[model samples]
Target chain A: MNSVLPNRAWTFISLLIAMVFLTLQNNSSAAQFLPNWPWLVMMFWVLTTPHKVNIGSAFIVGLLCDSLLAQPIGLFALLFSLSAYFMTTLSAHYKGLPIIQQSLYIGLFYGLFQLCLDVFSYASKPENSLELNLWPVGLVFVFWGAVQYSLERLSRPAPIE
Target chain B: MFNYGIHERIRIKTALASVSAVLLLILDLHFGMMNQARTYLYSITSPIQMVSAQISLQSKNLHQWLLNQEAQEETQAQLESENRMLKAQLLQFNHLKRENKELRALLSVSPSQFATRYRLAQIISIAQGSGQQVTQINKGSQHSIHAGDAVVDTQGLIGQIQHTSLLNSQVILITDPNQMIPVINQRTGLRGVVQGNIKNLKLRFIPQGSDIKTGDVLLTSGLGQHFPEGYPVATVDHITQHNNSEFLTVYAQPIAQLHQSSYVLILEQGAQ
Candidate 1:
């Protein structure tokens, strides 16, 4: 019964679904201003399931996104790997912080991810580079915190009476 | 201490991976050696994409099922009314079609020259940046979808397919900065290139003497064979002219609901 909760396989599957959902979410008309979900999701997994979402996995996800988006390959991979590394090493500290504070940290890291993407775009297509917006990063991180809280509550094993 | 209970091996591994990612990025950007590898990987990811698509579809269906009975009834009523109106329009449209064919025959022009076939596709995703806009559709090479096929909705041109895999294709929208479509001023038949701008479509290279107004409509001239002729492209919204400059700066709002439509049509050129 204890094994029924989300394990490595379940977590990996969930992350994949989340990544795909996020990809589709970008298609939504109202979600035009949302931050990149795959990056945030990678950071979440790095903090929660480091074994399943290692650096290699992060790079692969980023590479997949780059190809799917038709950008220069490896751009997302590089940024995602950097974010994963940061989250893995610093997530312990983040865990101890309050929810709002954790969101601040997530926003900062997500900003870094966006910054790298913008730099890549500018270099590759100077005329088409997008102006960066940091507000969406904060919004996404706050949403992520809420989602993480809900998942933790749902997945915690029932205590013996 | 350099670490707080974090394993030394993990730290080393992360550093190694980060460096590898940087190397991959440089290789990909400078050499573009990974395009083929990425395309091949899509064959593996298509199944995963299909599963997620089903999940999203089912959830949408579930949401509709959960709607209150009154709301569902009202929606059904609206749809039925809309269907009735469309049926009425269809009869008139058929009459107009016959007249159009007669006129073309009188002019000795073959109607087959203008004939086209379209496949309906669902928009699976849209990636929008400040100056970049790309959309992904569920149809791909499996459905005879090819790169450079024109994509449009009921209203006007949306984009053209940029890349395709087994079951999906990426469309670069008309608003993407990299995208350009040859267009003509429907009013005066003046030819020019409509280029994508971050905010609106720009009709570039038109001489200062060109008679273009704020409300002139633009249609594809079909010069590049990328987009078919006479399809509505945009409506001129703003026109600027410099006293000494040779060209006029004209901006037009796209007539197509580029960012709002959920479904699109992919025109397979020359197909009956």
Candidate 2:
């Protein structure tokens, strides 16, 4: 129990730091490659420790991201929270799946998130034309690969099992 | 503790998280109170930003220095030959002063304007977000820069100051969707409102039969009182005629390099 607390604390701090760095990089320029990092972090946390980092924490982090990045305030929060919840509920069934399969699934999840963000932004501001560049979506697969490799290396004894 | 259940603990935690998220969203949306707090917090973190910017600047400078050294080495022999040739050419050109003066007067000229009070400012930081594209300059209220003061660079009008802190001010660029400038065609004197489009500015409310044409210069009419009179805003790049509408759609490329430049001049209020 004592050991578990420190690990949880470290994970939380790492997630927070990732969120801040993502916000900074995303807000600086329109053409950036680093914004997808937070989604990877969120996905990794959800897959590894659902109980320790719940949907609520995801939502809060998403809200801060939205605020700092100046997207629709509640949009990212709501979507991220829902994504975490879905992952947590489905993690058990998918846990036995191969890493590449899991990464493809995560990439699809990120693509859907991007699609929703586009739809919401368009609906809110009709004047701004939607430029859907597939580059960011493609970049997510790279992040997914990294997440898969890192998670495997950092795997620990499953508390719930 | 005797009656506590696992489900109860989960519910309580979930509820607490939900409430907090809602509260944060409300604070972010309703009043922009959190934005103010964030700005204050950003000021505290600005030293870090400054250091990072300096590192990037130094790297760029180093690259430029290396390029200059290479160019000097490559040009050393050629420049020496060219210098002797240019000296001879200069002696020949010195006798053609009367011809040069006649040609200059025939060309189109920038109009003369009265001297105005100007405040030199360095861009401290650019707003880091999608919603508002603004730049913060080092000079602010302490420098007598009030809201609505026009900011310009050497080329032309850049923007107007929207908000001011003690040591910083936010300048909303002319390319921003929300910014509008009152302008007139310098050649035809046709007046129209130059509104910022997403990427460029468009002149709205110009009548279909207006004398405006491509390559005509647009100057601030000073009707808005926000910007000074006769500063170049943009050049008419294209004019489209609409069959059904009374107004002609005019698109002008902004003269100021709003994205690339780092320095600007904030015109002192009442100077114009």
Candidate 3:
């Protein structure tokens, strides 16, 4: 049990580091290439470890991102938590589906997250032209498809296992 | 022991999650108490921001050096020719200096005072997150750069300092949706608010009958105590009017290339 401490600590540290990098990458890409879909990271985490990456972790990470981006606080936290919960709940029913189907599910959740951001930002400042361009949605779907395909291939169990 | 129904357990968890999310959203929206916490969290990430900014700075410097090498060679040749012409002009101006001074003394008017403007330069780093539309600059609080300092390039005002750490400050550009600038139409003197759009800045709240037209230059009105007075902000790009609306929807193209401005000046105001 004591020997497991280092492994656990390392895992926690790595997760934090990954979260920061993902948050940074998401924002950078949103400004440069596409609006970031951080929900994809939440989806990936949930699909991999449903037990560890729960609603609370999502909430904290979302809050951190909201702060980093100077977004309305708790907006992302709520979005992330809700997205993770919905994804986790949906995963049980869709676990047997093909990779494309799973990707579609993830893509919809990410789209919803983007929608919430657009709505909130627009509602906050009505005069601002917050046009909802579908390009970011398309980018998110493509990213989700790639990530899901890669993860599915990488996580396939061996016959002996 | 007997187990609870799996469906019931899942539903209960789902309900709980929904409730928590609603509660968090309500709290964040109503209270805004998380701002201090957010600032604290941002401070924690400052080190990573500093390192990234340093790397960006070095790369930008190298790129600038290579570009300047050829430009400088041509500029040096031009300057040598221009220097002779300017020297002759200076000689002619000196000849009239005595007559100008006598006129000045007769009018009992002292010479105009000029404030020295310093150019403090910085390199911009990659934005930290996807949602954040801010850039981190190499200067910070330690450099006498404070919050609300106007950042500009050779073209026009780019942004202002949003957050600062020891050696890094985040600039929220004028093109960000959250940013607003008080501006005046340089030609018509029509004052209005300049707002950031996704791609460019737009002039908001000009009355429908306002004399603002295409090709008018917009300068900072300096109404809000935030930015200084009379700096070029943007040029009127497009104007739209609707009969039903009280105000005209005016859009302006920012004079500065916001995405490409690597070096900027942080203006230091003199004591009034």
Candidate 4:
């Protein structure tokens, strides 16, 4: 029974979801250099188990993150919902791509995500000019392999009894 | 809706969530319709944020200590004393000014007002990579703190309380473009507006050859009534003028350790 809980996709995925709060809460001055860990974890699960973890859950989790990070209530919710939509639509072809191409694909969307964040930041006060820093997207590509590998191992199904 | 395929169901759900999120964002931004809800949510999450800030600060100090034990110890001492030294200097200035006022009063001259009220609060966490240049504090409306109160450190003025929740508040620092302070040249009593350009504070509209010069001191003019009078705000660090410009470009470094100070004083509105 203990082993079964680890193999249950929903259980493991929820645990990953819980870590999102901790990751965002612990953000420090160097947080700008760090990739958005919660987003990457959400993408992995939404891509793999779209049925169990749907857009609604993504939106709710994003709201919690917004609360924790002291951002506007729905800024991240909007982004997460849009990301879930795109990922759910692309999950079919995403798994077939080679590692390099997969990372590049992730990078493409990650760049888009960073752009949205920057735009929202400017919209904080329209008087402030927009600033675009997409270097952290590179960190997403760097972390892509490790995040994907570990999550896959954690949620791997148990062997036949 | 019930007859839709699985993919179609997911797409519909996504559309609903996106639309809902946009609506929430609009209401929250334009009307602050969600402040009550947001505050309640913050009540639950703020403790976690506080814990994270504590851990990060402790880890940073530990890292510095391990990496350079002697140097870190020296730097810690210097930081601790820096606030005390600035406070002492301001106190001496105030004492002399008060004595001068007393002497003038003896001759039937006008007397000026001075300030003494300040409430202390500890730093919680600073907003990261945001252009707003705001920092959250541990005290809030529950502690009699309210919006628009002028916040200062041991050294000088930092910013004003932009807003307050029941448990936390954010201070908009002097270094944000949106903030402007009225400052007087302590040496010559010349007045100018100090505005922030992201990284530096610029004292604006000083006409060419005004009595201002490099290393001159600037203090609050108390013209706006938002900030307390006579607090050391900044020191003139640089002055430049274009060959044909009508005004001299004056830049001053802020006296308050805006990012470094752990505790801050908020001048209460009613007290003033």
lDDT by residue (tens digit), candidate 4, B1-272: 26998888888898899899999988887786986777676565565566555666687778866786788788889988997998899999888987988898899975554556778998777665443567778788999888888899979999988767777777888987778999999999899999975567999999987888888989999887888778888999899988898999888899999878988998887463
TM-score of 3: 0.66
Predictions' DockQ, in order: 0.39, 0.19, 0.27, 0.43
Which residue runs of candidate 4 sit more than 4 Å off their true CA positions? A1-29, A60-75, A95-102, A118-134, A152-161, B1-5, B19-44, B64-119, B140-144, B163-168, B202-216, B235-252
Best by TM-score: 1
Query: Pairs clashing in candidate 1?
Result: A27-B126
- Residue ranges of candidate 1 with Cα displaced over 4 Å: A4-7, A29-37, A44-52, A67-72, A91-107, A114-161, B1-52, B59-112
Clashes of 3: 6
**Candidate 2 Cα errors over 4 Å, as ranges:** A1-35, A67-72, A90-97, A121-130, A147-161, B1-55, B58-62, B65-130, B135-149, B162-170, B268-272
Q: Which candidate number would show the highest DockQ if scored against the true structure?
A: 4
* Candidates, ranked, DockQ: 4, 1, 3, 2
Per-residue lDDT over A8-118 for candidate 4, one digit per residue giving the tens place of the 0 to 100 score:
455445534444444444345556666666677788888888777768877976786676565777888899889988998898899899878778888788899889999
Output candidate 4 Cα RMSD.
5.3
Better of 1 and 2 by lDDT: 1
Pairs of residues clashing in candidate 3: A24-B128, A26-B130, A27-B129, A27-B130, A27-B131, A30-A34
Q: Write the residue-wise lDDT of candidate 1 on A32-53 in tens digits.
A: 4677766766677788777666
Per-candidate TM-scores read 0.75, 0.66, 0.66, 0.72
Across all candidates, the chain A TM-score values are 0.83, 0.81, 0.75, 0.86
For model 3, how does the per-residue alpha-carbon lDDT over B75-96 read when each residue is reduced to its tens digit? 9889998999888987886666
Which is better, 1 or 3, measured by TM-score? 1
